[model samples]
Target: MHKLWNRIPPLASDYSGVCSILFELNSLNILYTPSGCVHPIVEVDEIRNFDNVFFYKSNLSDIDVIMGVDDKFLAEAELLVLNNPNLEFISIIGTPVSNITNVDFQKIAEELERKTKIPVIIFNTNGFESYNVGIYEGLLMLAKGLSKEAVRNPKHINVIGYSTIALGYKYHLNELVKVLENIGLKVTFFASDGCIKSITEAAKAAVNFVISPEGVGAAEYFKEKFHIPYFMDIPVGLNGISRVLKLLGTHLNVDLSEIEESIVTRTELRGINEYINKNVLIIGEPLTSIGIRECLRADFVINNITIITNLNSTKKSREIYKEDLFSQVIFVEDEEHVAKYISQADIIIADPLYTIFIRKEDNKIFIPLPHIGLSGREFAKMEYEYVGKMGFEYFKKFLKSEV
Candidate 1:
């Protein structure tokens, strides 16, 4: 029987790429999903090597938050902060009950901070908002707390929106640091892969360039609070990097050599892209799904793009991306269906659950998790050699073998 405390049904996308990303970035074991949605989270944990992830029934009865009012959450925060004191930043996410009860998260956090000397911020994640909004807001809250520190140096530039996961962050951060430093921009700060010191010095940066929608709010907060200019857009692949260079050129009043390098790199990727087989069915998070699908389909034909996700509170991906661009699109809720469709596809780019389903089969290939931004494409291609040197190599290989 479903637990009484669990409220909402699990999102179909819960078990794969999106779940993996959240685990890698947030350092969370159990997501605070409603009890009814248990299966999706369970399924997501089935395939991946996620060690720090677990699920909690967040459907706190109205009585619990309003009347019973246990200090569980506040205590949990204090414990986490104490353990990770460098956690100068703390973000609190509220479930439906906490939202409706009008629980004073700020007050609770401030009280905890007063006693423990740690900063805690609150982000409301009730039904009104989607994960896209939740992630951005969470980032903003984290940035706001961080803005309190004095500037250490003007060369400090923060990487907003890339991520907190181990998958792509390792490669992306290294490349980004090299690109910015090569262009004479002193590196300031980076998130996900950033240290506590850099985060503490966030207010000191001259400007902020946000690469993901999730990073946009933090960029804006830094801009408004510190008089630092923030640029919001993707900074991956060739075109995305060019866009960043263009914006930086305008801000710093100088020509950007990064633009030249980005163009050359993109041209090289495009040449490699031509050799890739096109037929594919991509299953992952929306941002990664759309970005990868859009890039791959630019000059090649993508047979179909399927999003396997559990973020049911958000609209299906078919509505997220323009429908006219794809040959077919579907939002799947069942793993059995996902496996069946993948079996027929030439290539598959998805999380480990899907990967394990296809791993033993000679028909499909796995593309790994956290495939976001244009940069992920090149990373996938060159690093994995299955997509475009940086984009969709396994899918390409699968298609070649299938045809």
Candidate 2:
């Protein structure tokens, strides 16, 4: 029954891993339960050098879970906010214990906010749902808060769904800003590490880019209430950028060819197409998993693409790439198990989880194919950002290798 329920959940939570991504994106200052393990600490430490981070400890006990969020912890949070004059907000993430207790987190946050005169955002992080659900819920919470403080600014567009958890988010955003500015469009918000003032100006943008489905609800809200136009599923690849520019053209009533030439066309697709015929395993967010699957097929005779995605979050991407292309596309729930399968494949494209174990002797080429939407050119930008000047050094090696 336990096994059945584990598989039955539409989107099981992997909180430890997801929170690390959230932290990498600089979206929140996560508080840890005393009993929590080292995963968050490790991931947070990895990304800490890239951004500002602060942590707080909450010594939650089993007794507290059975009863509710200990009043003492809430009081501690309030005290911490009061002591830190520079603090802007506090996020209360739900732990497994808290979920089991069915604590009224919203009430606790409201009380904390009222007490500290600081914003308290409650996010459910029970490791029972997929990361996308957590991201979407977190964004919704952010939107609700921003809505109250939103300022009307016309001609700016909010870029939602590209969180800091993604590799090379800074580089990608900078490039995007330049591309949009070249076309005379102003970027209003980044949705990740984005300034509060800028986010409040979201209503000011002429159109919003629903870069990921996580932003779908926010985009719909703005369109319905503020009459802003929205373009959904604009990812980080050369062709993906082209699709975005075309959408912008339609919205602005301008020509798209020039924009495409300047951004997508000038860039080269990494010659990985020649090796696409080799059996490859893909694991990451659905947008990335599915987008790469289609993009690679254009160049390689993609044998199979084993996916590690929660179906609910990847519905849109799934609709784009049916089960026909791959010899088989399996939905994975465990990272370790998936990694073992990846070890058997000719090539592997994924985030750090899968890449951490690959060896030179295995003859399995590993590409840092994060699902953040970089095509050939955008990926180059990422390689430069995190890996320093050696950017693409590893990826390029993969491209040159024969499957």
Going through the candidates in order, what is the number of backbone clashes in each?
A: 34, 12
RMSD of 2: 6.6
List the candidate 2 regions with Cα displacement exceeding 4 Å.
1-32, 37-46, 50-54, 59-70, 148-154, 166-169, 234-236, 266-280, 297-330, 333-347, 352-365, 370-397, 400-403
* lDDT per model vs. reference: 0.49, 0.55
Candidate 1 per-residue lDDT, tens place, 1-403, comes to 1122122233222122233333333332222333433453344322334454332344444345556353765555556555655444444455554556667666766877687775555555553433444455556655665556575455556766654221243454455566678776776544454255455567777778665545666777777877788765443344444555777777766777755564435432333343365346666545445555655544235435555443332442223333343324465545566567777766567644345566564645555553322122223323432122243333344334222
Question: Which candidate ranks first by TM-score, i.e. highest?
Answer: 2
lDDT of 2 by residue, 259-287 (tens): 58755542244345566556777765555
Candidate 2 minimal-lDDT segment of 10 residues: 1-10
TM-score of each: 0.59, 0.71
The candidate that wins on lDDT is 2
lDDT for 382 in candidate 2 is 43
lDDT of 1 at 344: 72
